[model samples]
Each structure stands twice: as structure tokens, then as C-alpha cells.
Target: MANQTKADRAKIFMPFDAVKGFREALAEKERIIVPKTELSEERKEELDRRLRMIHTGDIITVVYFHDGEYVKLTGMV
Candidate 1:
């Protein structure tokens, strides 16, 4: 048997995830689907004004409800 230190021996028990889609495939098989959400009339009008106010070369962070959660994403206009 080869002489190995604690760090070297610890690596032997680490998980191997080299296969690209294996984890995603397993997650999809067990994922719970969430219904989509719609904005209210007042909320829609509020968002419209915010959109119009954003001019060229403006950066914005958009917050919306999706998949039973509030997701925030940033992008440049």
C-alpha cells in the first residue's frame, strides 16, 4: 500500500461529477413544477412607467415572481 497523507486520503472519498448532464437529468426527474404568476393591473401600469423611463445605455435590475419565488435579474438596456 502507498503512504498517503490525510489531505491525499480525503480526496479518495470526494464525489465525482465529471459527467455533464447526469446531475441535471436526475434533478429534472425529481423536480417539482411551480405555476407561473401574473401581474395585477395596477402593478402592470407601474412597471410600464418604469420601463419607459429607462433610456438607452441604462442598466436595470428587474425583480419578478417566478416558480413560487421572487427572482432578481440585472441587464443593460
Candidate 2:
């Protein structure tokens, strides 16, 4: 028999406010993964430096996953 390991899953409590503005609910909760890009070396360096300067609770814009679409949106700041 092959060895099998149990997978762990995290429960994400997406607040009601997160879905309030959307016309569709289930269509807005999809999986999204974005990789950091290196378009310009100078800009990338600046962003990295600024990221290190930010404090906890500071917000940033990221990709929002929908049922089949990914949208870029701004969150808390």
C-alpha cells in the first residue's frame, strides 16, 4: 500500500462586507494565485524596499478571485 498523508485546509471566514457590492455571491469566491513580477528592476527594487517599510494592518491591492474570473481590486489601507 502507498503511504498517504492527510491534507490540511484552512477555513477562510470571508466577511459579509467582502461580498456586499457584488451582484453575484458564489461567482465571487474563487481561487486565485498571483506571482510577483519583475518588470523593471528599479521599480521592483523600490517596491520591495517600500514593502519592508510598511507596518502591519497596512493594506495593498491584490487579485480577487471570482467563480471563473480574476479581478484586481483595492482593499484596506
Candidate 3:
């Protein structure tokens, strides 16, 4: 221990997942599979109108579905 370098000491405390792949498997099991819903004609028209109103520099928040989940992201258009 007395002769160990700074880099060697840092390596001793490095983080690691004790249970490999266990967290991911648990998360996958907890996730509910949701079916995608079809949008009605009126709903589709409303979404189209809102999309057309967005400009290049506008800041917008959008909810989109990916991998069986709806994620909301806010950023500049």
C-alpha cells in the first residue's frame, strides 16, 4: 500500500455493477408492453396543424413513443 501510485489507489475504488445484467433484466421485467393507439382523423388534423405552426428556432416539447414507452423531450426546433 505504501508503494502504490495515485492511479493504483483510484483503481481500487472504481465503481462496478456487482450483479451483472441483473438491473437491466429487472427493468425489462417491470416495463409494461403497451400497444400503439391509432389516432382519429380529427386528432391527426389537430397534430398536423400544431406541427405546421412550429418554426425553425422555436422551443417545443414533444411526447413520442419509442421502445414501448412515451418519452417527453423539450428542445429548440
Best by lDDT: 3
Score every model by TM-score.
Answer: 0.51, 0.32, 0.70
How would you encode candidate 1's per-residue C-alpha lDDT over 19-42 as one tens digit per residue?
979999997777656666688999
Clashes of each: 0, 0, 0
Worst-scoring 10-residue span by lDDT in model 3: 30-39
lDDT for each of the candidates? 0.84, 0.59, 0.91
Residue-wise C-alpha lDDT for candidate 2, range 1-77, written one tens digit per residue: 13433332222333445556574655445444455443598877987897787776778776645544567886665
**Lowest lDDT block of 10, candidate 2:** 5-14
Compared with the true structure, what per-residue lDDT tens digits does model 3 show for residues 1-77?
Answer: 89999999999898887899988999899888787778999999999999999999999999888888777899998
By TM-score, rank the candidates, best first: 3, 1, 2
- lDDT for model 2, on a 0 to 1 scale? 0.59
- Stretches > 4 Å off in candidate 1: 1-20, 26-32, 63-72
How far does residue 7 in candidate 3 sit from its true spot (Å)? 8.2
As for candidate 3, its clashing pairs are none
Query: Which of 1 and 3 is the better model by TM-score?
Result: 3
Count of backbone collisions within predicted model 2: 0
Q: Residue 23 of candidate 3: its Cα lDDT? A: 84
